[model samples]
Target: MKRGVRESIAVSAVLLAALFILPLLVIVPFRSELLTREPPMDETEGEPFVSGDLDSRTVLKVKNGDTVEEMDLGTYLVGVVRAEMPASFAEEALRAQAVAARTYTIYKLQTGGNHGSEADICTDSTCCQAYISEERARANWRKNANDYEKKVENAVTATDGETILYGGVPILAVFHSSSAGLTRAAGQVWLNDLPYLQAVDSPEEGDTIPNYYSRAEFTAAEFKEKMLAAFPEADFSGPVDRWLKNAVTDSAGSVETVEVGGVTVKGTQVRAALALRSACFEWEVQGEKLVFYVTGYGHGVGLSQYGANQMAADGADYKEILTHYYTGVTVEPYSFALPG
Candidate 1:
């Protein structure tokens, strides 16, 4: 080959490589997939995915409404961290959230996921982790937009490629906003009794959390209507005080079971029916209404965001916070990597 020809080919190759690399450099980590609601598929994997292995190049398929979003692991996690944790939280707490979000996504991928082969997870908070677009986060932060965005990005990057594992496998790393003084055991909130998700003390209380304690009042007639819709056999014939009876709760103050009317109902069932903030609640009948005194928010399971922040403030690192919330789990980096 002539020298000029070889030189010309090398220059073109370099330019082509630069073209691809430059875009990635300038592009922001934020991305949002706009899709209609996805049609239901056979969710064989009830919750998470299988095979706890991944590399830097791994891509996650996230179900957003009706469309599937494909993005690199790092990029997807940045959006997840921003949506899942408040950037105003301590840096360590944000990092803990970042690791939890990362572990959750990987668990979904390893467990084969539910959205068929098309997706490994979903954007719906009720289903999987919550994720948001850059614009939405910016709008929510307003004046603190730039700072908050950087905080989340740093949190994610700081813990890049890390995960919480149990028995060398990626656990279902579930988390919530707060707990009622204690996190619920896996068997208490889920079918399986995962050792790592044992009930543990949470540090945050009413003083730390704005809505640590809440109330939901329903008139006697309204209460009966809603209760009957869920528990048709519920007996609401007696006095308002007798409507809730035989309340059973755990040491952590999590209401386990209660008798509503004549039907025995789980606390979770009651929470869903009444739209209460947490399962840890007690009710009082005053006048013609029943007021439920609720404590904490979310499902009262797994890691508590507020608790984590408190721990961070107390001088605990991200790993320590995670280890405390998710018992017997190690915060470790993934072993698998792509060959250079």
Candidate 2:
């Protein structure tokens, strides 16, 4: 009750009040603003952004053609899963798509996006990832629209900020509609050989997948024209059957090196030039026409949508499905931070 004791009590009271009130004043405003501002990407350093302190509600700049739109990361992911994978797919498959799509978006944002300073990502499935408005997705779903919308929304919410990571880094997470029994390797499909994007066994096959097996027929003259368009130096003047020769196939039966008109060309190039469903194809002279018996769809790299659905049907969870297709990887809540 003396003067010194009263002064100590007064100091303690002030310290306690400051501890509780100071944090709210400092944190509340920054957290709210995090939803609208661009991710702090330091361009001069030429390094991926990394930050330990970040609000959970991340923002993304989406490039929809010429104009750019900004929205919550979760909202952006829901649109991507809705556009990239069918709502009819199993819930686990949808969840896998959600995580993969999120990783792709984050990776692009951190690793010098293709759009430069304009955007973090784009809506084009070919360039970035497909994204459609909820109204349009509902219109496409029709009768089961509400259920489908809820399913996609649930998938994104359930996975939240999860992402597929390889070596503690968010990967490219490239995916396709389907695969040719087995998914293709990164080096086989693209220039870089990512360790996690190697070829792996995929379960989706047969008639269950659309265009699992298809044929593209061209007359000898038509085949020559298409081949010449890509391989201008190649000679297609020979017996129709002989023109397509020396096809070196991968273990999955996808063409690795195929001799087109005696000129060795990559199977991927043939798929591009002929507009085939996939690189896993073989050509033969069926009567007067050159027929290419193609299998599966897309570039056959990374996650396979139909394949993921098949795995989900077999009782695998989202984590299991993603890891299976992506080789050595882990599914965990992503550290939504810009790499420094």
Q: Compare the candidates by lDDT and give the number of the best one.
A: 2
The residue-by-residue lDDT of candidate 1 on 1-340, one tens digit each, is: 6999999999999999999988876653432322444667434312221222343467667788899887667777877888888889999999999899888878877766777766778888887889997678878998887778778777877787788999888888999889878889878765678889889998985676888889899999999999999999888878898998898998878788899888888888899999999899988889889999999898877899999999999999999999999989898887532222
Ten contiguous residues with the weakest lDDT in model 1: 44-53
* Lowest summed lDDT window (length 10), candidate 2: 46-55
Q: For residue 129, give model 2's deviation from the true position in Å.
A: 1.1
Q: Write the per-residue lDDT of candidate 2 for residues 85-108, one digit (tens) a residue.
A: 999999999999998988888888
Whole-model alpha-carbon lDDT for candidate 2: 0.85
Per-model C-alpha lDDT, please? 0.83, 0.85
- Cα deviation at 195, candidate 1, in Å, is 0.3
Off by over 4 Å in 1: 1-55, 335-340
